[model samples]
Structures are given as structure tokens and as C-alpha cells.
Target: MKRFFTALALIPSAAFAHVGDHSHVAATHLLTEPDHLGVIGVVIVIALGAWLWRRGRS
Candidate 1:
């Protein structure tokens, strides 16, 4: 959990790039947009649940 939060805090630092005179958007959008960030959060929760399920099965 600590590592996950740390990565989230640092990801924005590398999501940007300058293109000619404009800023290119890709990963940065995920951090900047609420809807996109929400989707990511949902995915993370689903993934964590799956991991726990598999571990319990074993």
C-alpha cells in the first residue's frame, strides 16, 4: 500500500512531454481527469480483490 501510493505520487512527474510548443497528453490525462482517475481506482480495487481471491484459493 505504501509503495502503491508512492508510485501514484510520483507518476505525474514523468507523464509530461513538450511537443513543438504544445504539451502532449497521455498518462498525464489519467492523473488530471477525475473520471479517468476514478476508473483507474476501480481497476486497482478489482485487481487487489482478485489477488486476495487467488491467494485464498491456494
Candidate 2:
């Protein structure tokens, strides 16, 4: 049982092992582009609106 748990813990690390091995082109663009900034701003506005609405309900 102990060995099984240990192997299970390693599964996620092994699954992501190739994540750092390549350049992620989309991720780079998402962070640096002005066009994507509008999307980020919308997300922030929605999140804040949801939080305020919940606060008002409580």
C-alpha cells in the first residue's frame, strides 16, 4: 500500500515532465500582446462583479 501511494504521487510529475521541454508559443503571445489585454481585463471585471454580488447577497 505504501509503495502504491508513492507511485501514485510520482504520476503527476511524470505526466508533466515534457511540459518544460518545449517553447509554448501561445502562452508567450498571451502574456505579451495588447489584444489579449482586453480579455484579461474582462475576466477581472467579471470576477470582481461576482464577488461584489455575493457580498451584497450575504
Q: Write the per-residue lDDT of candidate 2 for residues 1-58, one digit (tens) a residue.
A: 4664566566453334333433546677656755456656755775687678779999
lDDT of each: 0.62, 0.58
Q: Across residues 15-47, which tens digit of lDDT does each residue of candidate 1 receive?
A: 343223225657776587766566577668856
What is the lDDT, from 0 to 100, of the residue 48 in candidate 2? 82
Give the Å error, residue 31, model 1. 1.5
List pairs with backbone clashes in candidate 2: none
Provide the TM-score for each candidate, comma-separated.
Answer: 0.53, 0.49
